[model samples]
Every structure is written in C-alpha cells, then in structure tokens.
Target: MLLAILLPFLSFMVRGKILTGIVCLILQITLIGWLPAAIWAVLSLNNARAERRNDKLIRAMKENGR
Candidate 1:
C-alpha cells in the first residue's frame, strides 16, 4: 500500500526517532494505504523517463557537436 512505498522516504525525510520509524514501516503493511503507493509509482516512473530523455538529448548534442 501507499505507506509501504513511503515509509522509507518518511524515515529519510523526518530523521525520526526509532519508534516513529517503526510505526511508519508498520503503517505500510495495512490495506488502507494503497493510494500513496500509486502516487509514488507514478512519480518514480516520471522521474525515470525524464532522466532518460535528458540523457538522450545530451548524447545527441554531443554527437552533433552542439
């Protein structure tokens, strides 16, 4: 679910205490948090595509002496 995908990010984002980190990790295991997972997937995929496009453009520019 959403929490499952976001728990690690939250842990990194908050620099939280161990207890809160554990709670966030556990929250991901529940069925009620799927929307976050979907959002996370979309964002990650878009980032990947953007990186690929940038790389391709840079390579093309190099080849063309641009």
Candidate 2:
C-alpha cells in the first residue's frame, strides 16, 4: 500500500506483475495517469484484503463444520 502511495509502478511490481509495473511507470512519468494509477492501487488493495478475509471465513466455517 505504501508503494501504491509513493510509486504506483512498484505496487504492480510487488504483486509480481513486472510488465504491468513497467507500463505503469511509463504512464506515471508521462504525468497524466497518476490519478488513475492511485485509484487503481487503492481498489486493488481493498479487493485483495477482502479476498483474504473471505478465505479466512471459509476456513473457519469448514473447521467448525467438522
């Protein structure tokens, strides 16, 4: 998330998306895609956290079922 704030490109790179990160870096350098990149990073982080929470809930439910 910090990378999302400091370098939007690093966000994608940290996620193992080298190509996308490179592209984002180029776009960011252009000075026009910064806003979109920030928004995307926020949304991406939120979605990832939600998925992790849901996975934990599913695991708990299965454990309780047994």
Candidate 3:
C-alpha cells in the first residue's frame, strides 16, 4: 500500500527509466507474489526490538542490584 504511493518518488531517485521500471515491477511482485516474506520481515524486526528491550531491562536490573 505504502509502496504504491512512493513508487514515483523512488523512480525519480533512481533516474533511469529502465531501472525504475524494473524496480517497480519487483515491488509490485513483492506486494502480490511475495507478501508473506514481507510480513515475516516485519515480524522479525518486531521480535528483535522486543529482545533488545528485554536485554536492556535485564541489564539495568542487574546493575541496580550491584
């Protein structure tokens, strides 16, 4: 959804019509042909953030105890 709106901007950044066309095609394929992988990427990022937060909290607790 967001990618559709940003497509023109991305195309402008790349500055090559052929490359832009190929990139847009890949993005479209990602949105349709490979949605699960995108979903997993988001999920994995969220999990990594959660793990980092937990590690920070645990370290803080240990430091306070000392």
Clashing pairs in 1: 2-33, 2-37, 4-28
Question: How do these models rank on TM-score, best leading?
Answer: 2, 1, 3
Q: Where's the lowest-lDDT run of ten residues in candidate 2?
A: 36-45
Tens-place lDDT per residue, model 3, 1-66, is: 233244532432333445544554565465563454344334544665699999999999999999
Clash count, one per candidate: 3, 0, 0
Better of 2 and 3 by TM-score: 2
TM-score of each: 0.53, 0.81, 0.51
C-alpha lDDT score of every prediction, in listed order? 0.54, 0.82, 0.52
Error of 2 at 44 (Å): 0.8
Deviation (Å) of 57 in candidate 1: 0.2
Q: For candidate 1, write residues 1-66 as lDDT tens digits.
A: 343254543632344345644554455456674455445544654665699999999999999994
Q: Give the residue spans of candidate 3 off by over 4 A.
A: 1-33
Best first by lDDT, ranked: 2, 1, 3
Top model number, lDDT: 2
Clashing pairs in 3: none
Candidate 2: residue pairs that collide: none
